[model samples]
Target: MSAARSSGTTRVVILGGAAMGSFCAMSLRDQGFTGPITVVERDPSYARASTALSAAGIRTQFDTPLLVEMSLFGADYLRQTGEIMAFREEGYLVLADAGRAEHRARLAEMQTATGAEVALLDRAELSRRFPHLNTGDLACGTLGTRNEGWFDAWSMLTQARARAREAGVDYLTGEVTGLEAQAGAVTGVVLKDGTTLPCDWCVLAAGAHSAPLVAGLGIELPVVAKKRTAFAFRAPVDPAGLPLTCDVSGFWLRPEGQGFIGGIQPPPERDDHPPEDLEPDHDLLLDLFWPNLAHRVPAMEELRLDRTWAGHYEMNMLDQNAVIGPHDRFGNLVFCTGFSGHGVQHAPAAGRGVAEWIRHGAYRSLDLGPLGWARVRDGQPLSEGMVF
Candidate 1:
């Protein structure tokens, strides 16, 4: 049985139901678009999903102005949904190395220029703010004085999907086998169950699984699944006021429901993975993470080790950034893949921008044309620094 195809109805089928896909559906309905939106998700447990397995944290202090703007917009949306999301303003603290003084100065300048309420603090100020922190070998840090925190990422994702459903977004559970196209435009998607869902617009929000699905249509996307491993530890003492702290070396820690969670990017060679591999690299945590944290905060030596897990980030090879908006060859097909690791925090604004692009053919809030596939095709890189 082949998937059914249609043209009259403005049906929109999204490929994934993680944070980005669900957020796009929610934003479309919020903006009063009455078109039919359908979401397809294969994983019922969502255990291996990035949204669920991430070290749930959010921050607005970024080096790139566009990235900071996107984060601020996302933070604002989270605040507005406090009643629905049960969002807590837990705040975030970013620690830097003294050797990266130039980068620190640049980030401060960018934050101020973008009007982010981020503060640059010296080691003394950091110690004053976080009295428990050991600033023995520190330089400076950037703190999101307000509007930075972590929420139940699972809760946030479920809420967005639920709200989208309430707003008439249909959801299907299956793997995308292929896409149906005509005249270089997407018409519908074929699921593993042989069900064809017709749509006027299609978004490739399938996260790590996007590559194979889109590849079936002969559209070579650069998004590759890169594994990120994280570990959770029970704090020996009450780490209540512990802001989500990210070290200059890319290691980050924050509070989960009952314990403190942390992770660092694996060395570049160790980051690549095959599509089906979901197991975490626990050896990296034992070898690298422990030594790094022990060197920075000796008190962490008392923390009891919790279980570790891994998730995939759909990394774009071109610039190691996101490939947003539509593809050049197929205007009707929208894509928001290759977010590297920042997809969770950037979901809100990216969702809104994608929704507007579908409705108005342009994003009125912020022009995401810079992230379009045209740049990749043209061999240009709008490289934004401070990527973790």
Candidate 2:
């Protein structure tokens, strides 16, 4: 912990210069850390980065209180600095069927308790609010009236990376091969070119590739890559009153200018897509999402499918929750990955939290202890109630 206080001389290295790594670098600087910082990313173009391929949705409708808090904080941070990210505050609406109505209503109450502006509506009210939606099968619905929407995720990442570099954080383009550790501290980072960069502190934010990077160190991180497909389409439904709506039929949709976008996580049996395979599966859009869209919003029955894309979600196998804070085995190595699909939305808060941990040896603003490495080490899963 003594090393945390010596901010002026602490050398830090971050892996994967995407959303998480870039945010952490900027936040570290924001926290008054004058230490030398370097962010190494394999792809400087970020063409295939998860941050660039996401559906770009943000929401504070989760059932977990801490996650809800993170969402609120991230939303505020984005609005404050998202002039170029196309920040949208349209909000998120989740529909519940008869069986899950009471449970979902309970979640809405919890979200409201956590200062999330949300409202619970019954079937009639849901129909009144979204007149085009086929609410005959819905028992109730929850709507986040504020701080819940989508934005351009790639823009956010790019801005953070640029800001970090402008603040004197070095942006290194390299393929990290492994970590060099001695005793309990990470001594250096080994690159694919056999170049080793010495560092006093290391942050692992490699997203889906995080597990493989640390596996040789005898650390088994449950973070893995899961393929998610999204489609953009023009529909008869009105985009004016629509929110990023999640239906009971296991699909979510939202407005994007002249058209709407929607997608779903593939079934577990077929979700084992190779991390390198990014081919869009149009069959799922036709067979799965279209039917769900037609069932939820009758207006979308005539929707015309357009361009589609596929990406990987850094899914935590043990629990769909993020793991942050100091690594148990290597004290100098802080983890800021394993956010499942919520990485893009939670990056701001989580990155700030990481900076706090590195600068003060404790979280100053938000207590992210509940999502620390101890749980992952002890096999205690802090699972979220549900994921979107």
Candidate 3:
């Protein structure tokens, strides 16, 4: 089995039924693949799942052309199912200081050329549009004028699961210990309960937990679980036209109903937090976030800290981009993991790409080769300049 699948798959088993996995199941049905599809998830409630705890923002503000194209497709899909997923087009704004203004302009040029509606705003223009923001120290900003914003991740996950189930994809509750493979081809999935379900094709979309499973099978997947904390707060500023603002001050803030939610990615040295620690990083609010918040938006100085929570970013340390497509050796076993922080938003595109690969032996909609396994194997990282 090569990039073009040798034969049509009969039974497909997907490990980890989160946003990525469930989307694949739904797309499989949409592609008219009438085989037996099974999704194995450790938790049916998705209590600790990344999809359930994410900020659920979607955007077309990627640096890579392939990624920009991928997110554009996802934004379209989410818009078609807008009401179902509570999708909002509030847009995203990323700021750049004097030093990086030139680079930001270059990125905007690249994005706009890829058909993304990006508006590169100077400091004057940025201040005019979002007066509440403290753009005194900023040189420029890029705003996604259309096809960007937030959505309810829980709704997207549950709805996709329900619809995929209704379309005859079996949902199984179990923890997959490892892949059962022989002669470089995945044959079945071994559960913790000692049950082995055979599969003609396997999709390993285990998210942040994908590393260990493939390690046991002699594969290297650099995806890891990194902790990120988001805080909800109430401020006096109106949420009238505030986009999901990524200030020059290291934190991203968005309008979440009557209040707002914001967070910052910890520096690499201090981000080695265990996945099991779901406790809120209240210290961030006191030290980094609070100061930055008040500095970026002057009115936020009078804000009240409502609450805080944490979630694991399924990080691809090597590139910070997604690791998609099949394993170089195990062609029947495709992967849809390692989306870092944008998995939920990009799930629709990833799923459609993977499903098309499994059914038609090649990608029909988006050519997902740029994010494939070969890049990972060769250690050739196609890094994204702006991933927030």
**All candidates: TM-score:** 0.93, 0.97, 0.97
Give the best candidate by TM-score: 2
Which parts of model 2 are misplaced by more than 4 Å?
1-4
What is the lDDT for 258 in model 3? 90
lDDT of candidate 1 over 277-345, digit per residue (tens): 879898887778877876667777777877878888777877767778887777778888788777788
The count of backbone overlaps in candidate 2 is 0
Query: What tens digits encode model 3's per-residue C-alpha lDDT throughout 159-181?
Result: 89989999989999999999888
How displaced is residue 90 in candidate 2, in Å?
1.0
Query: Candidate 1: misplaced stretches above 4 Å?
Result: 1-8, 83-86
Q: Arrange candidates, best TM-score first.
A: 2, 3, 1
lDDT of each: 0.79, 0.88, 0.87
Error of 3 at 124 (Å): 1.1
For residues 114-226, write the lDDT of model 2, one tens digit per residue.
Answer: 98999999999988878988988889989899999899898899889888999999999999999987877788999999999998889999998888777767889999888
lDDT of 3: 0.87
> In candidate 3, which residue ranges exceed 4 Å CA deviation?
2-9
Shift in Å, residue 100, candidate 3: 1.0
